[model samples]
Each structure stands twice: as C-alpha cells, then as structure tokens.
Target: MDFKDYYVGLGVSPDADEKTIKKAYQKLAKKYHPDVNPGDKVAEEKFKEATEAYQAISDPEKRRKYDELRQDYQHWQKRGGRGDYNWDRWQTNPGRGGSGSQGHTMSPEDFAEMFGGAGRTGGFGGFGGEGYSDFFSTLFGGGGGQGRGFSGGSTVGRGRAGQDTEVDVQVSLEETFNGTTRLIRTGEKQIEAKIPKGVRTGSKVRLTGQGGPGIAGGPGGNLYLNITVSPHVHFVREGDDLRAKQPLDFYQAIFGGEVSVRTFDGEVLLKIPPRSQSGKKFRLKGKGMPNIERPDQRGDLFIELSIILPDDLSEQELSTLQELANKRG
Candidate 1:
C-alpha cells in the first residue's frame, strides 16, 4: 500500500492538539459522512479516508508513531528516494511482530474518543487490508500472526462501527414545559423529532443509526441532539423551576384583587392580598418546568409582583392615595 499522509487527508498540522484534531475531523465527517452522501462512491471513499486519518492521529500513541514515520518518509523523499525502502525494512523485520500491545498502539481512550468506544466495541480498524499501513502495523504491531487489536478484538483493519455525531437543537421555554416536536434536518434526512418535555440545556436526545455510516457495512452510528432552551419572553429558568414578573396596578395592591399571570399552561388569575408590596414573591405550585427524570413531578413557578403606577395620575387618584396613607399612619 502507498504511504498515506493522514494529516493532509484531514487538513490538520502534524503538531495539532487532540482537541484541534477532533474538531477538524468533525467538520470532515459531517461533510463526507456516508449517510449524507448515500450511494456516492467518491464520498464514501472520502469519508473512509477521513475516518482513517482521525483514527491514526487522534490517539496520542498512534499519532506519535505516525508522526515519526511521516518525518522519515519526508526525509527519505528529500534524499531522492521513494518510500519503498521504508516499507520493505519494516515488513521484513521479525521484531515488528508484537501485535501493537505496547508502543505505537491504539489506546482505550483513543477508541472511546474517536470511534465511540471502539475499544469496548472492538472491530477491524485498518486501511484497505493489512489492518493498517506497513508503517503502523510494522511499527505498532500488525506483523504478529493471528494478531488481536489492543481493543481485545479481532485484528484491526476490518469492519468498523460508525462514528457518533451530535447536533445543537434549541427549543422554546414553553416547549420544555409541555413537550414539543421539531423538524430536525440531519445529513440528507429530515427527521420529525418529538422532543420530550423537561429537556434543558445540555440535554441529549439520541437517534440510533443516524451518525456516520458503518465501514465495511458494519453499523451506522448514533446521532445526538444537544439541547439548548431558548430564553422565554417573560420567564427565566432555574433548575426545574421558572420565575417571571407579574405586573400589578397600585390600586390592585392597595385593594386586593386578581391579577393576570402567565404560566406555561396559560393565563391564570393570581389572587393578590390587600397591601401587597412591590417585589413580593408568590409561588404557584406545580406550574414551573417539568422534571426530566421524574415525569410525575414538576417544579413551582415564582412570580414577583411589580406595582405599576400611572405615569400621569389624575388629581382624584392622587388625593385618594394621600388619604389612604394618612389613614394608615
């Protein structure tokens, strides 16, 4: 197999950090994901190539080996020599037969981060054949007979499970209180997603078999919806509870009356006691956001009364207020 430049394939520098490499791969995966480009051979190949590059470098151990080999390849080329000698040397080296259990191997962390727990769900992870390249297998250990991947699975370079993906989804505050449905566009598919009630920011809605297409027809990965609840026009969220301001007229505060209060359910009449002060807080039991884990439970809504005085009070109204103050004194 020809030596592949994994860094060039993913458009990342050799010295890029794990976070940067992951970010670069995410963009490529989204663009060339097989699900997004069904039946397109070119796209499929590109997707596979990107996946290959990510696996090679996203892992520190694997990346270190690749980097070292890449330098050797570059240096060899500079000496007016092709990569044939490098390949021939490692392929014939008997000491290269370690099965990649130690140096230049894929780690559990690498598999989990890049392949969505590939270490736990081990499968083949190599180029067209030979599990990996001449350099990787030779340096890392594909040279062993009946070799097993570090993941404790069959030899690498076979079928691989698809990479998982995530999409940011925003919902209205009311939606969180009373569940909602959204038309989510993923890849080439438009999913009519029924968002459960009580999903807050950081909530994840997983869609099975919706991520990157499986390699060697293994299995499609999962897609996740990262929830972000939009701010409400009149309310702010606090845990499962909600808070809002309810405006009350000065007269209403002085002479107990019902005030219109907006809740997720609808507008309700909130009873105001006589002599209610501005900024007074009232709890409307079980009227807040729903508890995601506990379907049977809901939070309370707190309303702070804000007294609104007429901008231009009539003489009669001013005189009545003065008389009320005098009586109170």
Candidate 2:
C-alpha cells in the first residue's frame, strides 16, 4: 500500500499545533465541501481526503501511532530502493502465524462492509462510507477501528469525546436591548437559552455538555448557538451605535424648538437648532444599544431630521402668509 502523508495532505508541517491543523482543515473542508460543490466528484474526493487526514492527525494518540507507522514505512522505502511492499501484514499487533484479529488482514468483504456499499450516511469522515484506503485500514484499523475513535460495538482504547453541534437563533432588536430567553427544541428535548443584552448578529453562545452523547463514558460535546439579529423597521445598527430618522414640522425646523424624540429607553426632549434643515443629524449620548462586554456603557443615538411642510392652507392663512412674504420681500 502507498504511504499516506497526512501532514502533507493538510498542507501543514509535522509539528504544526492542533489549532493550526483545525484551521487548515476548516479552510479545506469549506472549499471542497460536498455540500458546496454538489455532483463534483473531484471536489468530493478532496473533501474526503482532507477529512481523513484531519481525523488521523487531530488526535494526539492517533497521530503518535500514525507517525510511528509512517517512520517505519519511510525506512523501508529507503532500504528497498523504491518498490511496493506488502502493507496488509503491517498491523500494530500481528497475530502468530498471520492469524490473530481479522483486522490484521482486512478482506475484500470487510472493505465492502466498511464502505456500506457507497452509501452517504455511515462511512469514513461520515461522508457516506466511501471507505478509507486499504493502506489506512492496514496501519490504523479500519474506519470503524480504534483510529478516529469510532469503534462501533468493539472496545479498543480510552473513551471518546462527543461531537459538537451548531444551531441558529434569531432575536428581535428589542429582545437584544433587554436580553431575552428562548426555548430551543432539539429532537424531543427542550432547552431554554438565555441571551444576554447587546448580542448582535453573528454572536456565538456555547453551551457545554449539550452535544452528541459521548462514547465509552466520555464527556459529552458542546452546543453552539449562532445569533441572527432581525432587521428593525425604525432603526439601523452600526456596532453599538444606533441610527434613526425623525420627522419635524416646518415651523419647528425653521424657528428652533424642543422636539419629542423616541428612544429605546423612553421619550426624551431633543433641542432642535434654529434653521435646522432636512437631513440634519443630532446625537443623543448613551441612548443607543448597550455594549456587550460592558453592559453599563452604551453608545450614542443619531437622529436625522426630516422637515415636512404643511399643505391646504385656508384663504385667511394664505393671505397672512402672502402679507408676511410681502413684508420680507
């Protein structure tokens, strides 16, 4: 079997840290994800390759075992002057007389079973069981082997951690102002999610021990809730700041007066400057959204004034306006 270089596949060095490996995997997976490239066999294959590589190297124990196997293969290659060697017999623990665990020498039938007849639900990388290569299975057990920490019913090594899950939660602008509680339905279980004040779009809240059940009594996974803030009809958000449009009568805009302004807190009197025109903006400090990190602090609210002119004046009023215009002229 050909030697599989997992580090090279992930475009990372052998000593790369776990965070680097995860970032590289996420990048590659996003680019070649089967969901992103439907019906593209090449892309699908690449995704599987990256997933397989990540699975092999992400775990410290698995990576250590794989590194040992890889070193031995490289030594053999150096000694043999470049030629194919029998990889089927290269199990970590070989049985006496080539007869131990059937895993030592996976048969064609076993390989087919591992792939699950090319179905997409239960296989390597959970990509519908396309099956890992014979070389991979030979060194680190099959897809269901101790490698990748998925052993089905067969117990091999220590306990396996649970899988993380993500879900989307939408909140209104008002809900974000004062914080709110939401009920999340996962399968038959219902969970109440507490959203703190100042959470905006793309905010992530992680709930520990709420993911997939662990294997072999390991700790459960975590649940990540992604916040999606809905659009507001009256106001728009820019970071912690808020922007809104307020209407003003022609008399108030021209002569300057106190105007009632509506904010998240309550109605406040805003001083309108004399000769204020349409599109004039006013700042109200500490009247906008709260800061996520420091809830005590807040941002300023900007209100753009829109001047509206009165219409359908009575004859007497029109005459008075004309007399005033005459005097001004």
Candidate 3:
C-alpha cells in the first residue's frame, strides 16, 4: 500500500487543530461509509482509506511517530541519495567521465554523517558520532568527507518501500478490564490481535511490516491498530482508575454492614462503617486497568455510596420509629 498523506486524505491542512480533524473525519466517514455506499468497491476503499488516515493522525503518539517517519522519507529523497548505492563497488569503481581512481564508495550511514547527519537529530542521517558516521560512509559511500561526484557517477537502482496502513479497533470495557484477544477482519485477511492488560482507550498497537506489500522485494509497511474502549454500564474510567456507585439501603447507610460491590474482576465484599454518609467513597488499590505500555502498574478503583429509601413501612416499624423520636425528644 502506498502511504496515504493523512492531511490530504482528510482534506485538511497539516496545521489543522483537533476540532478540524474531527469534523473532517466525521463528515467524510458519513459520506463514504461502506453501508452508505453499498456494493461500491471504490467508495468502500475511499472510506477505509479516510478512516485509517484519521485514526493515525488523530492520536498524539501515533501522529508523532508518523511525522518522524515522514520526515525521514522526505529527507531521504531530497538528499538525492539512491536507496541501492553500492559503496564497495563505488570505492573500487572510478568516476565516470573522470579518472578511474577518482571514485570512492560511501555507505548510507557515512553519507548521512558527512551530509550533517541528514539534517535532523537521531534520524537516518544527521549528526551521528564520528565512528558511526565513518562506518556508514565506508559501507555506503557519499558521506560529507567525499565529494558530490560519488553520487553523480553511480547509477544504482532503488526500490520503493510499501506504505503503512492504520485501522481502528473498538473494544468493550469488559474486554479491556480483563485483557482479551480478538480476530479482526481487514479486506480479505483476518488478523488476531491481543489486547494487553492495562491498555487505555486511544492506545495504538503497532504490527511491524504488516501493512502493504513492498515494492521490488523491499520491506513492507507497518499496520497500526488504534483502540477505542466502549463505555461500561456500571463503571466509568478515569485515567487508570475505575469509578462506580454502589447503592445502599437507608439502614445500611446509618448502621454499617458488609455489602456486595462489583469490580472488573468479579463481585467483592465491602464493609460499610457505622454512620457512613451517602456520598462516602472507598478506594480499591490496584483494581483499575493496567497501564498500556507498563504492564506492572495498575490503576485504583473508587466506589461511591448512594443511599436508597423504602417506599412504605409497616405499622410496627412506624410505631418503633415514633417511639425512638419521642425518646430523642
């Protein structure tokens, strides 16, 4: 798959804000949804493309990664560096239309280091240390130490790599809480994805080199899985914490006792203190979702108390209540 220009795909500018991105996505999604364009393969493909593009750029982390990759690719082209330069042959082979001894081969890394490390920090080319830079130059040829003649004389054939693909996967709150695996159908293939414990909504899972097929046997692109967690019936997610209301009877609120509470794992017993207030909350440490990237860390769970009252009371109960009130008076 050729890499889709996300901004272009969404018909927005590179500097578009979150609101603009969302608006574009919603408008495009509604118009191009598969259901709306039934049996129209072209429309369906467009819809899928738009959806994938939106999914990639809408996320902060994924956007950052995409930006880096794009910058690297652009720089690669701008440098006029052919992907398939043979440094060994270049070093041994003389420059065309010049003295045979004048030609020298430089590795890609060396070429980058010599050309100011490819103009960006920590990227394929700019500013790597002397040792690394020299190593690459020796391997690929065309580094800063060599003149521009090396690239001009060589006629190396470079293969274009495949473009990346993005997909959005929505998971239920229960699946997120307990960690589950699902099979996703894309185009004609089914991919099995494992939802790791502690992944939050909007987290992305990267399947390296699984996107579009490579051109001329080069490495294929990557597949990005954007996750969306569905809302739970009883639980609300706050960061890693899970929050829910636990209803209690008036008597239970006034006189403490053991009450059953629901958790992501299962039902658990929670003790209510005597004279506990209706708005009181309890925290269950390490009960919330796991951190998506950090498996060892877990979030906390909070339970808010709600007091319920009976609609009617027996005559004996009413008499007992009256007597208690009289004694208090």
lDDT of each: 0.70, 0.71, 0.62
lDDT of 1 by residue, 1-329 (tens): 56789889989887888888888987886676545576777875676567657777877877777787788778667645622543422222233444324323344465366555342321233323334434445555544334443223433344344777888889888788888888878778787777888999988876766777766654566678899999878999999888998888878998999988988788888999999999999999999888876656899999999999878898998899899899999
The estimated TM-scores of all candidates read: 0.52, 0.53, 0.56
TM-score of 1: 0.52
The residue ranges of model 3 lying beyond 4 angstroms of the native Cα positions read 1-155, 323-329
Cα deviation of 147 in candidate 1 (Å)? 15
Worst 10 residues of 2 by lDDT: 94-103
Name the 10 consecutive residues with the lowest summed lDDT in model 1.
119-128
Q: After superposition, how far is residue 123 of candidate 2 from its true place, in Å?
A: 35
Candidate 3: deviation at residue 326, Å? 5.4
At residue 166, give the lDDT of candidate 3. Answer: 86
Q: List the residue pairs that clash in candidate 1.
A: 124-158, 125-157, 126-131, 126-157
The candidate with the higher lDDT, 1 or 2, is: 2
Instruction: Report the Cα lDDT for residue 154, model 2.
Output: 32
Per-residue accuracy of model 3 over 1-329 as CA lDDT, tens digit each: 13346788899987888889978976776676544576777775566556556655777765676665556556545646444422221121122122222223234454345333442221112112111123222222323234333332433433333576888888898887778887866567677877777667777766666677666555556677899999888999999888999999889888899999988778899999999998899999988887665657789999999998766888998899899999999
